[model samples]
Target: MRLELEKRPERSKIMAVVSPIAAVVATLLTGAVIFAAIGIPPLKGLWVFFLEPFSSLWSIEELVVKATPLILIGIGLSIAYRANVWNIGAEGQLTAGALAGSLVPIFANSWQSPLTLVAMLALGVLGGMLWGLIPALLKIKSGANEILVSLMLVYVAQLLLDWLVRGPWRDPHGYNFPKSVSFDGWQTMPTIGDGRLNWGILFALVAAVALAVLLRRTMKGFEIRVLGEAPRAGRFAGFSSDRMVVFAFLVSGGLAGLAGVIELTSTVGQLQPNISPGYGFTAIIVAFLGRLDPIGVIVAALMLAVSYLGGEAAQVALGLSDKAARVFQGVLLFWVLACDTLILYRLRFVPGLPAGETAR
Candidate 1:
């Protein structure tokens, strides 16, 4: 009898370039299979989900709207991940930022303009930073696991938003709905071409440009790379791990907060229980899919946005359930993880099994 064990493949220099594309293609193929299983034609489903969004103005607008927050959150995550700081609580930070930014609008009910927007954004950044600082502090002082702390905060923030909207911040006028009072003209987000599309798109584009420069052209960026690629080297060079952790989390949290600010002012125009469709969680996928590059995130975000639109199309055209779209998103994420694994490790066969090997 012979025993077999798979060996990891050698690292390929070309895998870096091919991994993301492979992930995308694999996701598409998997989605097609799902469509076939659901009694729908794969070609028609692909056309509706991928092509139809770009064929019309309204659908394209929706794509931009969906992609905006995703890009913003992805940029922050790219920076954090590159610095070796794992922050999984971006969703919580987002919720806190939205709630903090909306306080002025809810209470004042009189002041509104460019200034209000600026204050709201500033508060959002502060709130998110503070939220991120919690785990950072714990990790620094007590050697706590940042991943657990950050992820747990997401549920806390979600509960807080629900409490505020349903109890204290509920709209006092009209009917008893779990929503905040809507902001007037100046308080609302500015649109593109008289449509629901907001200046958040501009903000997203600006952030992408800035992060691209920050990651590629700055001294601080080099430090982050050093910390991530070789932590021991960073320590040998006298870099402070504690400081880096705090800095990375704060910056990431602040960006997520900025995303929340844009989302509230531009889309919902008021506080709601569900501010996002889990953009914060999904941005993690975007960061990895983009290979932790800011410019690549822009493209990845757009692809994800296309999937969102396609899911809607499937719902309407093929009478599929909302869960069907979720399945596609999950498939995309799975394929991305699998492709990244292949990029990092290849499989090989050995002539014979070594000692300690057992086979059926």
Candidate 2:
């Protein structure tokens, strides 16, 4: 006997909605087992890893801050994926954006005005779009695989940022450190109150609402869905796949870039060797977890943000490794994909049938 997967004739609408919830439950159970294996009480470990993040006002604020970047990046990614354009180089685009946005503060340190902040934000989005455009053009012009090209560019962007920070952009007054001059005055994002929460959260909320409108109430959204679901039909409808590809990449890259600049200005306050905590990569999971819906991504982003806070809290409270958060994220993604697969396909056993052969 052998097991095989058979695609369902029609996907169940109910299962589609339940898939993410099932994945979350499965992840929690698996996390419990992992905690037990590590010699920590499962209940205690789970509390620290999940529930503890919302126990205080400060932690809640940090959660919002963490979720902001995820929401922004996830919204853009949802649009790209909807159009069947896989732009995986968001991390690179984010780095490029941060680098471009930092130019104003690093070189023109004396320039302080509201317009200065506006320029930096604009530059951030432009930088990301430019970085993303490379793969789009290559794919359209030369038929190159976007996945490979975009992923490879991430390392290039990282190396470029590393060189700049370690060499030209290093802070002169500071003792040897891989960082640029600190941003001040209008260079940094303004906070709502005395807490760490900043205006970046508002940007994330606005992006989600805007994209929700774009995807549901516009012709462009119809094109994206049509192209993704049935490219032949989209062609028949006179939608240009090439333009869609460019649009997807530019939109996703720009959001990622915006997130990067906001993170630098609001949280870090300067350019550093490592500015992101893998927000771009994490946002991919966020996009999928939200079922590629912009509004859903907001909630999903907050869920993932808990893991980041939990990771830090676990280290201090439970003596867990800093990498614990990544492990949880990986398990969550695995379960999510698994559940989604089951939603669209059923498992069958074929007795006395050879592998790769269907029962007649």
Candidate 3:
């Protein structure tokens, strides 16, 4: 018998919550098999991949450091995706934010003040908004596909970053390298403890909480949800679809930009081409894994952060390349899509025609 998917009258709410957990469980099972095939003890390898990272204080701090940007970016993406804006260029927005935020530090290298920090944050948001608006305008005015436009912009941002670091932004006094001069005390982010943890973690948490409130209680939030779920209904209710698209993209881009600046000032302490290790893209997974809720995004971000820490642990212990995060994310994304599909549809077996049967 063959199987076919039949549409469900309504989506399963239980499935919506359970799918992310199921995806993680499935990824662990798959990882175990892959580890065993690679000659590593399945339990030991899995242990290293998942649990070992949490066993140390330093590791926990590192997780927060890694998760900060993910949470920030994911929260923004949650807003955009919920509104059906389809903004796939957060990576580009992030890069643009970093580029704009770094301008003050790069050119005014000697200026040392707290205001520099404030300026960076503002410029970062503005840069991201401008970059994000391009596709929004194109889509609204010319019926262009935002998905393609945003994706292509990623390449542009990356190339622009590469050019700046290797040329103008490069430190003049230091040895030849494609990197900027390290930030001074005023330029660098303040630390919470002895470790590399910064205030950005706190910022992430606050933003998530604020966004959660905005989405759950605000009239704009209601508008966004209505427009996303049923545009026809939203219009009948007097909401403008075009306006929501712009609003969603701007908020998304602004948050992503803020994340970029935070990563620069708080973590990296300088502008570099490799500032983000696909945090923008990985955040897409985080957003879905969180079910597009801000608080949920925080949880999802921490889980993904564990993958980064675990990858490092696996590399150190098993001498394996640290691709744990990427692999886990890919599997998780696939499973999320699968679960979402199944939530809206049920599988039914279809009988095949008997071999003896002949067409008339």
TM-score of each: 0.93, 0.95, 0.94
Instruction: Return the clash pairs for model 1, or none.
Output: 9-346, 49-310
Q: What is the C-alpha RMSD of each candidate to the true structure, in Å?
A: 2.6, 1.9, 2.5
lDDT of predicted model 1: 0.86
**At residue 37, what lDDT does model 1 achieve?**
85
Q: List the residue pairs that clash in candidate 3.
A: none
Residue 190 CA displacement from its true place in model 2, Å: 0.5
Q: What residue runs in model 1 are displaced by over 4 Å at the alpha carbon?
A: 1-13, 349-360
The TM-score that candidate 2 achieves is 0.95
**Model 2 error, position 333 (Å):** 0.9
Looking at model 2, residue 204 earns an lDDT score of 95
Best by TM-score: 2
lDDT of each: 0.86, 0.94, 0.88
Q: Point to the candidate with the largest lDDT.
A: 2
